[model samples]
Target: MSFTDSTEAPIYAGLVEEQGDVPAEVRRVAEEVLREADRAIDFGTVGAASAR
Candidate 1:
C-alpha cells in the first residue's frame, strides 16, 4: 500500500492544496519511513547472505 492509496492521502492532498506544501513533520516522518524501509531491505539481503 502506498501513501496515495492510503486513506490518509486524501487528507494530505487537501492539506497540500490548501497550504501549498506538506507539513514539516509529515515530510520528516515520510523521510524516516523511507529510511526504515531501506534498512529493512538491506537487512533482508544481509540475512540471506548469511544463510547461504
Candidate 2:
C-alpha cells in the first residue's frame, strides 16, 4: 500500500527524469507534495472504510 513499491517507483522516477532541469528546491517540494498526497490517499481510504 505504498507508492514506493517496485511498481510505482519507476513511474515516479520517470516523472522526475522527464522534468529534467527542475530546480533543486522545486524537486524537493515536489517530492514532499507527492508524499503528502500519498499519505492523504491512504488515510482517506481508511477513514472512508471505517465510516461504513
Candidate 3:
C-alpha cells in the first residue's frame, strides 16, 4: 500500500526496518495505524487520521 505513496516510503521503510518485530499488541495497533492512514489518505479526509 505505502509502496505507492512515495511521500510515505521513507517512513514506512523505517517502520518496517525498526519495529517490524514488535510484540503482538504493538503490532496490532501499528496495523490499525497503517489502516487508518490508508483510510484517511485514500479518502483524503483530514480529521479522521488524528481521531485515533
Q: What is the C-alpha lDDT of each candidate?
A: 0.73, 0.71, 0.69
User: How do all models score by TM-score?
Assistant: 0.37, 0.38, 0.37
Candidate 2 regions with alpha-carbon error over 4 angstroms: 1-22, 43-52
Model 1 lDDT per residue over 1-52, tens place? 6444337699766666677665666889999999999977776678788888
Q: Give the number of the best model, judged by lDDT.
A: 1
Q: Indicate the residue-level lDDT of 15 in model 1.
A: 66
Name the regions of candidate 1 deviating beyond 4 angstroms. Answer: 1-22, 42-52
For model 2, residues 1-52, the per-residue Cα lDDT tens digits are: 6443547687765665676535666889999999999977776678789889
The lDDT of model 2 is: 0.71
lDDT of 3 at 5: 51
lDDT (C-alpha) at residue 40 in model 2: 72
Clashing pairs in 2: none
Q: Identify the runs in model 3 with alpha carbons over 4 angstroms from their true place.
A: 1-22, 43-52
Cand. 2 TM to true fold: 0.38
All candidates: CA RMSD (Å):
8.1, 11.1, 12.7
